[model samples]
Target: MPRAKRFYIPGCVWHITHRCHKKEFLLKFARDRNRWLDLLFRAKQKYGLEVLNYIVTSNHIHLLVSDNGNRDTIPKSMQLIAGQTAQEYNIRKKRRGAYWEDRYHATAIQVDTHLASCLIYIDMNMVRTGVVSHPSEWRWSGYNEIQNPKKRYAILNYRRLMELLGCESLDALKEVHGQWIEDSLKKGKPAREKKWSRGIAVGSREYIENIQTKLGVKAIHRKIHESKDSSELREDQSPYTAIFGTENERLRQENTYRWGLF
Candidate 1:
């Protein structure tokens, strides 16, 4: 089959995820998590990327991010980010070879509805794993950032997140976010489905269709590779986006200086 077109457009949001080899608790320790986060931050600074939301589970990670329009550096920046993370993991564990199972999995998010669904899926991941009763109870995710807006974390883009969520005021943003989490918690843990792979078993048909359009294909295929167990495959690796970059240069320009912000 022919390769599909890439979906790395300026201002287009994507839900990106990656998992460890064999679902082996790659991020079981605090240092492991911090190391990954540090590398991600450096990538953000170097590539002009913006993270809308993220969650780092023991074996996998979920990220909602958008191209900062830096077409020249997005790929290079991501390579550095993933490469450094893997290197650190191997060095700390005294092991060699792959850390994450495969290249990252990502779906371009084009609509507000899709954005809402993605956030819901990410926030409820811990609950689905039986680790927490509610999303707000999870400390390593954007749900906590929603709960405490005063606290700023490099991994989350709260202001833009609120704008995407249709927030006109701080109170409104908090109220809507809190309510969304409560709703997801009330739904209880997500049940695993056999046919669907990665993330919640179901999402809006519209969202899926939109992604298919962006991918320039009617269907998305997963090419699963083996070097691990069943749970490990599901836990640490996702056959997501292999490529993402923008073609527009105007969007790549830094507006901070123009606004007298820097």
Candidate 2:
């Protein structure tokens, strides 16, 4: 399902999930995945996107990033990466139609502990799918890049990531990252979390409410949900239904409209 109207508050971290059109295996090949990462690197160089973490799966991708106080950066970077990757793949394979599903969905995240959880959540995506036993096995993930920073062509903004995570240095961050993954695995199998993908905002009560306020009218009918450890603000009503006020907007219109009112 789609999220709440893509309302992004600057300086907030976001968990972005984008699937291939119709959930197809368009990026089933390694080269395609690598190309997608290549474009991500270009986005880093071009737009200064403060990437924190990412994972490219066969059918979709999970990208974690901070808005960095610039509203256009995230959208521009995503367009560059998604558009170029899709164009190149289509040209090479001679395919047609849409590449991605509508647009990517983003969830606002609170910094510190909540942000750490999102990072681990993105890391465990492949593991949850049974593609590999551990996130480390998935080379395309930010997991690999975090553990072993590239000498050249790096996509992540280490300084921003460190500041957001409250880490003193890269070593400290890496250690903490590894430990969190280990703890999650030991606790048992990880599952697909909807808050990261579908919710409007995921964090503490105050943080989520702040996001909702920033959204203003878009947050209408959206309510805050609390669990044992965290809180999320989500809309019970579908965005389509909220806008059109009907389960099926098409059905509400006369059949004569199929051939025009004339």
Candidate 3:
């Protein structure tokens, strides 16, 4: 079956997720996590990848970045980071085979509330998994860096993030970010699982439809019936329900290489 072409709209913020092969704890140790972060730093230097937020969990990773309208930058950065991380990990562990389960899932995020929601989602991933009580407790995530500017890690581009969030100063951005995260926690809004990881793009209805039109794909229809499973859809008003068709359906019907994620 042909793969779906990845949508790379310039100036869009993307939430990317990639899991370890077989969902194994490939990055179980702190050193391995640091290694991945090192490679990400290198990718930033080499390709100018504007990383906004990130969290390196034991089995998977989530990254928020702005494409700046460059189609090749994200793919190239991912290739370099994932390829080097896997190669070094294999050499050290004396293991061989696929390290990543599949190509990373990239979902375009609207610049408004959706971006903020996605950031909170990524930040609170560890908390949702019972790994930490708060996102600040996770050392490998952007929460600590954003909350404490003296972390001395140049992973997140604070100025750019603030710009995107429409904040004139770092202090203002941090205030709003902290308040939002606190409110979400108090309301128990952090999802145990995210539908953003499963969809093509997430934003306002108009924004998603525009992307569909630009990609020359059929518009996604809302699910007529909701499933009872927790892993299924939720009542969130966000336009995250618009999936870019299933991979098998795309392969059979479009016969094109632009298949969505597995």
Candidate 4:
């Protein structure tokens, strides 16, 4: 089947995730993880990609970045990072095959509450997976760098992050960011559901509809009844999901848990 079209609106934050081929632990080692981070750092400098948050897990990676509306910036940055990482890994292992499963999945996030929620989600990924009790303990994530004022990782754009959070100062941004993560931890980790990734876009009803119209997708309404009254579903479902709903059922049936080393 043809791939679904990806819509990139200038000045929008995107939550991107990509998995290793066959779900293998390609990034299980610390050196490999560090290499990925180094490559990302270079990509940021070269492409002007503004990375707000990120986490590198054993077999996958989550990156929250904002494009300056260049259209090619995000794609080119991903290409440089992913390609270099894969090539280095292949040379080290002396093997030839695809490193990534497919193209990275990018979901446009609403810049307000949804953006904050997505940032927290990325920060708590290691905690959610039971790999680390706290985000600070995870060296492969942005949590530590963001929390420690002295530690600086050039990959993260602190000014832009603060701007998004509506904070007036770096101290305020750090305090609020730390509190956000702590509060999320207190609430317990959320289910690693596909809502963040599977949707065409994530935000309020109006936000999704706006993007849908921009993408020229036909808007349709489905009815739901509670008791004797009928209500209309206002949210726009993913175009991919709407057309391939059955695939999700198959994925659910095959669900299994696998534990890995930190």
Candidate 4 local lDDT, 1-262, one digit each (tens):
4554354555568889989999999999999999999999998889898999999999999999976757788888889988999999999999899999887878777888778888888988988889888899998887776887544456788888888879888789889889998888888865684656655567766666665454433223322212221111233444545643443333322221111111
Ranking by lDDT: 2, 3, 4, 1
lDDT scores of the candidates, listed in order: 0.60, 0.81, 0.76, 0.74
Q: How many clashes show up in model 2?
A: 0
Give TM per candidate: 0.71, 0.88, 0.82, 0.82
lDDT of 3 at 226: 24
Model 1, total clashes: 6
Spell out the clash pairs found in candidate 3: 3-257, 3-258, 3-259, 4-257, 4-258, 4-259, 5-258, 10-69
Residue-wise lDDT of candidate 3 within 1-262, one digit each (tens)?
3333454555678889999999999999999999999988888888889999999999999999997555677888899989999999999989999999878988777788878988999999998988888899899988877887644658888888999999888788889999988988897646664556876667766666555555443333422122232111112233432445465334323222332232
* Better lDDT candidate (2, 3): 2
Q: Summing lDDT over every window of 10 consecutive residues in candidate 2, give the lowest-scoring window.
A: 253-262
Evaluated at residue 202, the lDDT of candidate 4 is 74
Question: Best-fitting candidate, measured by lDDT?
Answer: 2
Collision pairs in model 2: none
Best by TM-score: 2
Candidate 4 vs. true structure, TM-score: 0.82
TM-score of 3: 0.82
Candidate 1 wrong stretches, greater than 4 Å:
1-10, 72-74, 150-153, 192-262
